[model samples]
Target chain A: MIRRRKIAEALFKLLSLSALALAIGTLVLLFGALMVDGLGRLDWQFLTSFPSRRASQAGILPAMVGSTLVMLVTACVGIPIGVAAGIYLEEYARRTWLTELIEVTVTNLAGVPSIIFGLLALGLFVYTLGLGPSILTAGLTLALLILPVVIVTTREAIRAIPVHIREAAFALGATKWQTVSDHVLPYSAAGILTGVILALSRAIGETAPIVTIGALTFIAFLPPAPVTSQPPYVSFEWLMSPFTVVPIQMFAWVSRPGEDFAANAAAAGLLLVGMTLVMNGLAIYVRYRMRKRVSW
Target chain B: MEIRETVSISHSSVMESASHRRARRRREFLIEGALLLAALVSVAATITILFVLVFESVGFFETVPLLDFLTDTLWTPLFDDPHYGILPLLAGTIVTSVVGLVVAIPVGTVSAVYLSEFASARLREIIKPVLEMLGAVPTVVYGYFALLVVTPALQWIWPELPGFNMLGPGVVIGIMILPLVISLSEDAMRAVPMMLREGSYAMGATRLQTAWRVVVPAATSGIVAAYVLGISRAVGETMVVAIAAGQNPNLTWNPMEPAATITAYIVQVALGDLPHGSIGYQSIFAAGLVLAVMTFAFNIVGHLMRKRFREVY
Candidate 1:
């Protein structure tokens, strides 16, 4: 009986270790395969030129530019609103049924599938509001998609500020807004910034919601220049211009038949994966450094 | 003389005038109002999503009978002679999700157990980020990997496996959701208090026995919540199935067959040039509503489970 029990324990340990190994091994395999297939395709030409009928001539220029512009809009619109909401929830709102309802709604929104967001954008933005599948619509769709993440992270960061700190500010004749802005916001900025970066990273790789809003898969030209030598140096024309993002571009290539297009898809995937990993790495590093510095 | 001059510095000048005080109060009030509006955006978003889905689906259900939508097996909204049965898509979703869960649950659970109960803290810190990276990888990339890599791999084991079978995407999804399951389950297991394990050890139980019998049972509700969330994720996953599983709406449970999930169908219709307000376009909203309802139900159950079992120690 003792021997049997010992053997069972050893077997269970082996099972557990192998389970972890399997997960790590898969990640290694994925990166290795992408490198082997796509490394040679990464070049200045590939970065600068427009996608072509011939797979060798194709580039990610238009797609990359569109992604950047869309991200700009998403950041501008999403971050301030998300941060304010977070501030309201953590710093100001009293515990009440209405706050509880909002909390539940936010949680539920976070779980709603990305594709559903796409459907919402289609009905609301594209048709009802007549945004017409522009970068603005895609940005708004993704802004809503990332709002819950931002809010949750912001709230957590604010909550981490010690109550004594807030009390001290209050005793110093600081109003609620003054305490939050001067104490809470500054203290939590690192955490909130990390969350923002992570959220943007997630949004960057999103394809379904963007695709559902009917992002064009093929675009040979970039949007109207955001900065130009013309009378008004900055332009809003790009917001309404048709756009294609990297993931959608990759998807288009992957669906087509041929080894050449497959290679291109692999190359695009490498770039997308690399970007998200870097952002995640940065977020982790920021959190680690902040935790080391702050005891309370 | 200098001390008297300093002492006599005007107190009234230092204090804010009534107008200034009122202005500051007004500013505070405006800021609060703005912040409240920002918080309400989430509520508005929820309401708008519901309205959009239901409104379009209402238009769709008007033409297609509700009974046929539920009971019929076919789903060909784009065909010349259209059928709006959602079962085929639903079947596809169930099959793939089941296959994914089969692979994920055991492996993820084991990994969680190891991380929470067995591994050293330093080892856990390293492993945790790597697992998070797996979740962070783009789904589009996973879709590509599923189509180009995993499917070819399965063909070696099963010679008759088609180019676009559900098995490849299902397995990849299992890998995709593995991190989620591991992290959430590990959190649950770790929350099982240390005294319970001590009690088991005092009773002459081995570490494995202690974890299996004591901690696992204690954290059962949380683990179940993790599983439910994983199921919701698998069901809603779009790109992997879209790229690997063929877009045919086949009503079968076989993992070896090609089929379209509800999400994949929505993508297909969106990619096409279906006119706005047409039956084909309207059909996607109907499909989306069903998808939303299913995931929403799972999420609520998971939420309740977590809430009910929290802080049990």
Candidate 2:
């Protein structure tokens, strides 16, 4: 019986080691496949060109530009409301029933499926509001998707500020606005920025929500540039322009029935993986810097 | 000279004090109100999602009897003779989710055990972030990986395997949610007080024996919570299943067969152009409603388990 017990323990340890190995091995193999199939395809022309009938001629410029524009709008809309909500929950709201309700609601929202958010946006923004399938519509939908993330992260950052700092500000006769804006927010800016950037990266990787919003799958033309001449030198028309993003483009390629399309899909996935890694790496580095600077 | 300057400063402050205080107070009220409104947007979003789903789904049910929608075996909303039965899709979802859980639970829990109990701090730090990075890799990329890698590998071993089988997507999703399970379960294991392990050691328990018996039992609630959350994610996952699991809604118990999950159906319909307010378009909303309720139920169960069993220390 003692010998059997010892053998069982050894087997369990081996199983545990293999489990970790399986995860890392799978990731390494996935990266290897992507690099082997995709790296040669990525070039200046591939980045600059638009979708083509022939897979070899296709470029991802429009999708890249569209994704950037969407991210810009999403950041602009999501960050302020999300940060304010975080500030309200952490610093301003007293322990009340209403505050608890908001807290619960945000937590639940974080768990709601991204596709449901898409369905809501389809009904509300596309049909009811007549935003059509424009970048603005997709941007607004993504904003809702990432709001809970931003709020949660921002709240954590703000909560980390020492209580003594707030007390010190109060003792000096500074009003709540002055105290938060002048001191608390500035001190927590690095942390909050890190959170915001990470949230945006997640937003970029999301495909289903945008897909459900009826974003044009094939686009040969770019959204009118943010700077175009008509009356004003700057143009807001691009917000209303129909667009396709990188993940959507990748999905389109993957769905097609041919080897070339498969290669194209692999290439697009490689670009997306690169973007996600870079963004996440930046977030980590910023967080590391902040952690190093503040002993508290 | 300092006293004179202080008095002058005080006099100037007093001269502006009443109006300045009033302005500051007004500004505070406005900003507070605005912030409160901003916080309420999440609540508003929840209400909007629920309201839109129910309202649109009601329209769908009016066209197709609610009983038929629930009980029928087929889901062909786009065909000439449309059958709105959601059972096939639900079955597909359940099978794939079960397959995913089968892969994720054991692997994730074992890894968590290894990391929490045996690994040194330095190794733990390096591995944890890599696990997180694994999780954060986009689902679309996972879809590509599932289609190009797992499916082919399976076919090479078993020539009878279908091109777009549930098994492939299910396994990929399991890998995708592994980070979530490891992180959450590891937290639970770590939460099991060190004293428990020491007590087991005092009784001549080996390291494996202490972890398997004492710590595992102590951390059961957290492990259960993590599994529940992982299951919820598997059920809601869209892209991987959509791309790899074939679009045909086949009602079968076999994971090797092609099947359409509820999410896959939603993506299928949305990818095409259906006229707004049509029954076909509303059907996706109906499917969305079902998906929402399914995930929400899982989340509530997980929340309850955590609340009941969470270790305070």
Candidate 3:
């Protein structure tokens, strides 16, 4: 019995360790495959030129621009609203049944599938609102998709601020708004920024919602210039212009039946994966620094 | 004279007129109201999602009987003679999710157990972040990896596996959700009090024995919650299945076959220019409504499980 037990213990340990190894091994394999297929194809021209019918000349420029513009809209629309919501919930809202219901709703919203958000945008933004399949619609869809994430993260960051800190501000004759804006917001900025970056990174890779909102798969032209030599020197036409994002572009390439298109997809995937990893790394760094600095 | 001068300066700086006080109070009230409105966005979003899904689905069910939608094995919404049975899509979802859970649960649980009970602190620190990076990697990339890398590799082994079989994407999804399962399960295992482990040790239990017999039992609720959430994630996952699994809706339960999940079907319909409010277009909403309800149920269960675990310890 003792000998069998010893064997079982050793076997279980091996099993567990191998599980971890398997996970890490897969990650390494994924990166390795991406590098092998994509490294040669990824270059400056590939980043700058427009996509072509021929895979050799295809580029991600339009897609990249679209992604940036969409992200701009998402950040502008999502951040202030998300942060304010977080502040209200964390700092101001009284603990009532209504608040509890809201809290539960927010939590559940975070788990709703990204595709459903796409459906919502299609029905609401595209048809009912008559926004068309524009950059603005895609951005709004992604904003709603990331809202729950931002709210949850913001609330967490604010909650990390000790109650005593708020008490100190109150004792100093600070109003509730004053205490929050002056003390809580400043102190939790790093955490909130980290969450926001993480949320945006996640949003950057979303293809389904963008696709569901009917982003054109083959867009060779850029949105109207946001800056021009006109008297006003700025334009809003780009907001209503049809756009395609990186992941959607990647998907279009992947679906094509050719080795060259596959290479293009791999290269695009490399760029996207690299972008998200960097953002995630930055968020981690921010979080680490915040943990080191903020003890109270 | 100096004291009087100081007091006058302090009074002028600190005191405000009644009008000014009222203005400040009103400003605070307005700010609070704005913040409250901002917070309500989430609630509003949830309501909007439900309304859009149900409202559109209502339009769809008006044409297709609810009984046929539930019981029919076919899901050919785009066909000339359309059949809007959701079973095939649901079956594909279930098969892939089952495949994913089959791969994920044991591996994830074991990894979590090892991390919580066996690994050194430094090793744990390195592994944890690496696992988080796995989760952070986008689903679209996973889709690429599944379609290009995994399918070819699986084909080499099986010799007859289709290029877009569910198995490849299912495995990729398993890998995708691995980190979530490990992290959540590890948290639960770690939350199991040290005293229990000490007691097991004192009773002559090996580390593995203690982890398996005592810690695992104690953390069962949390592990269950992790599995529940993983299932929800797998069920809702889009890109991998959409890319690796074929768009044709196959009702078969074979993991080796290509099938379109509900998510994949939605993506398919969206890829085409189906006229707005057309029956085909409305069908995606009905599918989405089904998907949403399934995930929502799983999420609520997961939440309750986590709550129960928290209450226990």
Candidate 4:
């Protein structure tokens, strides 16, 4: 019985190790497929040049620029709103019916389909508000998409901060705002900021909502300034400028006919993937360092 | 001389100090109100989304009756006053989701079991992070990978199917949501006390036997909840079905044939060529609402089940 038991345990170990190997194998195969299809076509021109009528000459420059502007704007809109909501819920809200309802609604909001948010943007921002199919409209839509994520993370961060800090501030006769600014926000800022970065990275790769908001399939020029003004100031023309993004462009390329288009699509996809990875890596690193600094 | 006017000075200074406190109180009230209002923003956002969907869907129903939209057989919104049948789209979405759930549930739950139950401490550390890495890859990448890789391979064996079809996306979506299913299930499985596994093994049960008969049943609710939530994700998934499944809305059980899910329809119209104020735009929102409702329903179920079934031990 003992000898048989030994053989069975050995078999289980071998099988389990193979299963782990299979998972890694799947990851490698995916990365290999992406590189094989994309790497040879990628070049400096591919990175910096503008889109062209001809398939071979077209580049991701406009798409890349548009993505940056939209992402920055999304972070601008989402982080403040999401983090503030988080702080309010964590620090101020009472354990009442209202707060419990608010919690449930937020969780449900997180589950709402991304496409619906696009529809909301199309109706309210594009049509009703007259934002048009421009960079601002898409950015706002993407911001809403990442709001729940930012809120969730921010709440967790706020919860992690020691209560003693808040007590110390209050004990010193600090007003509520002073306490929050001096102690709460500063203590939790790293974790909350990391969440914002991660959420924006998710937004950057999003295609559905932006496409719905009329992100151009092909843009001849990089995004014009989103807002315009007199001589030296920002102009309104910038706000109205049509834009393209890496994910939207990649979607277009993938659907087209030419075999070459597939390779280009993969190359573009790789760029988007690389950007997302870097953002996520930075977020993780910051989160790690921040947690290390905190003791209890 | 200094003592004579003490009353006047004290009175004025006290009045000024009281006013200053009042102003500070008002400012605090305003900021706190703003914070509460921000939390209320979630409620506003959801209502706005729902209201817009209903508004546009009404616009759609003006062209096509509510009954036809719900009950009709075929979806041909491109043609003249095209039959507004939503069944085919609904069917396609469900079929794909069912396929995804079917594939993801067992494998995800089992692998999760292996990790939480029998794997060494070091192995658990490695496995959890790898699952997270899988979770982070974007959906579009998975969709294209499915189209360029999985579909072609699937076609070689299943010659009866069309060139581009639903199976690839359905299967790939299963792979895509595997991490979610596994992660959630692992959490649930791990919450099962060690005594249960130990007791079963003491009765001379093998590891596999203990996992399947004893531990798994104990954690069934969590496993089931993961399946429910995973199916929701697959159903709401847009890009995979949009690209891999040929943009043809048909009521068919066969996974190999071209069939358009609700999300694929939304993406198709959203891509372009729809007249600005036409039914096309309305249909997109209408479909969006349907997708939203389906996923929301799943989320509620998953959350409730998770809460109710959590094992304290």
Candidate 5:
């Protein structure tokens, strides 16, 4: 009986260890495969040139530019609203029923699948507002997608501001906004930025929601300048333009039946992965700096 | 992941009435009012999402039979006598999701257990973050891997199966949600006190026995929550199924067959130029509503499990 038990235990341990190794094996192997498949194709033109009709001919430039523009717009729209709401929740709102409700709602929203946001964005921005399927509409969808993340993170940053500082400011007859703007916001800026960047990184690789709003899977056109150089730039008519983001473009390439398109998609995916890692790394570094400074 | 930040603004708001006596109470109210306004904005965002999905879904039912949508097996939306059955999509969702959970749960839960419990503190620290880094890798990237890599590999084993069968998407999604399951389950396991483990050890139980018999039951609720969350993620997953599990929406339970998930079908319909007010377009919203409600159910059950479980000291 004892021998049987010992043998069983040994087998179980081996199985579990192998399972552990398998999980790690998957990640390392995927990266290795991506590298082997994608390295020779990685070039300056891939980063700078336009996409094309054929796999050998296509480049990621237009898609990259569109992704960047959409991300910038999303960040611009999401940060202020999210941070303000976070500040309001953490700094000012009493722990009332409404506040609790908002807290729960925020958590639920975070779990709300990304694709649904695309649905809402289509209804609200694309159809109802007649903004059409454009960068601005995608931006709004991305903003809504990241709003809960920003609020949660900004709230944490705001809450990290010591109560004593608020006491000192109020004691000096500072108004509530003055206290928050002058004292808390600066202190929480680094943490809040980390949250925003992390949230944005998550948004950057997303292919589903934008695709739902018909984020053009293929577009040769570069993103128009942030402020269009043309007349009537601010009008609703301008918001109804075609847009192609990298993830969506990559998705298009990836789902193709051809091996060439698959290889191109892998190369594009490397770029997307690089983008995500950079965003996450930057977030970690910022938080580290903030932590070090605050510790001192 | 929801952290409670302890932000105490100086009790000075409460005490201001004593020192400065010119409608100080009103100023307090004003500050509170501003915060209330912001809170309302958040509340409104939540309401807006619910309203949009519900209203559009209502529009959907008016065009299609509610019963057939729920019960029928075929999912072709464009046939002149189109069958708007949701079963195929839901079945595809279940097959992939269950497969994903099967792959992830044991591996993830065990790894989490090892990280938070058995591994050395140094090893625990390293492994935990590395595992979480998996979570940070996006689903779209996972899709690329699943299609380009897993599908081809799978086809080798089951030559009869198409390249885009359910197995690849299911396996990929399992990998994608592994971090959540592991981390959350580990949190649950870690909360099990050292005394219980020691007692089992003292009674001559092996490490495996202690973990399975003592720690697991104690951590059961959290493990359940983790699984629920994983299912939610799998059900809501769009990119994996869209990329790896081919777009044909057939009603089949066979894992070897390539079928479309609810989200994949929505992506397919929305990917095309399906005119708004067309039956095809409304189907996307209808599918979205089902996906929304399904995930919502998973989340509520998960939250409730967390709430219901009380640790016995």
Candidate 6:
């Protein structure tokens, strides 16, 4: 019996360890391969030049600029609304069937395939709204896509506020608004910011929705600047300008029938992976600091 | 004199606070209403998705009989003689997902068991962040990796394997969902009480026996939920299959061959220039409807399982 038990223990240990190793090993292999294939293509010129008919000369400049612009638009659209919704659900909504339905909807939305979001954006924004495959449409699609993530995280952060803190403010004759705006939000700002940043990072690396909305794959010029000679110097025209993003450009390159383009795709993939990792790192660091500072 | 002074003070305060309270109440009501609207955006989005999918698919069904779309063996809408049969795409999705689950389930469950039961606190801390970082790597990147790295490696070992095979993307997606399955199942396992494990041990059960017998059975619902969610992810995955799995809509039992998934089909169509309102354009919405229903059914099953069978420790 003892020998059998020992054998069983040893076998299970090996099995579990191999599983762990597989997970970590895949990550290591992914990054290692990406580095090996992509490093040669990364350079100053790669960042500055435009897409070319030749893969050797093609750069990710327009895609990079477009991605940044789209993220900016996404942040603006997603953050305030998501945070507010989260605050409402946590603090104001009473325990009822309606609240339960909303909660379920949010959870379901989070699990919906991202491609469906692209399809929805294709239908609503590009076609019906006549946004014409612009940056604004792409940004809106991503904003909707990440809304549930932001709201859930924000609700969690708000929920983490100690009850005594809220009671203390209420005991001082503060109204709900004053208490939340002053005490609750200030305390959870770091956590909320971390969640928002992570969600935006996800948006940054997204490919499907943008592609579904017919974003240009080979644009040489940037979107019209936000500020220009238009009557409203802060031009809304840029929002209407057609755009492409990093992942789309990378996908286009990966599909091309040549080794050079594949290498170029790798280079772009490296940049994208680097950006996502950095943002995720920052979010993790913020979370760690928040946990340390706020033990509750 | 004291009675008069008290009366005056009470009267003045009441008069001053009435308008103040009204304004505050109105502001509070307005704020709450606005926030409620914000909260309902998700509900609105869900409604919009359903409406759009159904409304657009109406055109497709009008063009192609619903029975034919469902029963036909081939999906060749892009060809000259278009057949709107969904079987090939459906078969592709099922095969790849089965492949993914076969790879993910055992590995993820075992890892979760280890993480929850055996790992030291410090090890868990280090591993958790690494897993989170892994999950953060985008699906598009995974697609690229699957195409460039995994397929080449597979092709070397199995010379018969096609250039764009289901197995490559299947394995990559399995890895992609590992963190999700691990975290969810770990939470479920950790939720199982320590007393149960202790009881099994008291009965002379070994640690492995306790985990596999006592703890796993106790956390079955959560593990099931995790599996269902993972399957949902595999069913709806887009870029990985689009990039790695060949866009050939073939009804085959083999994972070694290339097959086009519903998602990949949608992507292939979207990449091309189909005029709006054409039957080809509307077919995507039809596909989307089917995909949406599939995911919804899976999610509902998972939710119900978790709700009904979850043990309250």
Ranking by TM-score: 6, 1, 3, 2, 4, 5
Better of 2 and 5 by TM-score: 2
lDDT string for model 4 (A203-227, tens) is: 9888878877777888878666545
Query: After TM-score superposition, what is the CA distance of residue A94 in candidate 6 from its true location, in Å?
Result: 1.2
lDDT by residue (B213-303, candidate 2, tens digit) is 9988888988999999899899999999999999999989899999999998989888899999999999999999999999989888877
Error of 5 at A147 (Å): 1.5
The weakest ten consecutive residues by lDDT in model 4 chain B span B128-137
Between prediction 3 and prediction 5, the one with superior TM-score is 3
**DockQ of each candidate's interface versus the true one?**
0.85, 0.77, 0.82, 0.57, 0.52, 0.81
Per-residue lDDT of B1-313 in model 1, one digit per residue for the tens? 9877766665554564667777888989999989989999999999999999999999999999999999988998877888889999999999989989998999999999888988999999889999999999999999998999889999999999999999999999999999989988888998888898998999999888888889999999999999999999999999999999999999999999999999999999999988999999899999999999999999999888887668576
> Which 10 consecutive positions of candidate 1 chain B have the poorest summed lDDT?
B8-17
TM-score for chain A in each prediction: 0.98, 0.96, 0.97, 0.92, 0.89, 0.97
User: Compared with the true structure, what per-residue lDDT tens digits does model 3 show for residues B173-255?
Assistant: 99999999999998899898999999999999988789999999999999999999999999999999999999999999999
Superior candidate under DockQ, 1 versus 4: 1
Off by over 4 Å in 4: A1-23, A226-230, B1-17, B159-161, B198-207, B311-313
Cα-lDDT of candidate 4: 0.82
* Candidate 2: docking tier: medium
Order of quality (DockQ): 1, 3, 6, 2, 4, 5
State the lDDT at A237 in candidate 5.
Answer: 37
Residue-by-residue lDDT tens digits, candidate 5, A1-296: 77777786677667666666766788887777778777667788677777787888789888887888788778888877788789888887777898889888887888888898888887788898888888889888898888899999998998888899999999998878778889989988999999999999999988888998888777887654556567765544334567888888788888777878877888888888888888887987898898889951
lDDT of each residue in A141-184, candidate 1, tens digit only? 99999999999999999898999999999999888899999999
Computed on alpha carbons, the lDDT of every model, listed in order, comes to 0.93, 0.90, 0.93, 0.82, 0.82, 0.91
lDDT: worst 10-residue window of model 2 chain B: B304-313
Root-mean-square deviation of every model: 2.0, 2.0, 1.9, 3.2, 6.7, 1.4
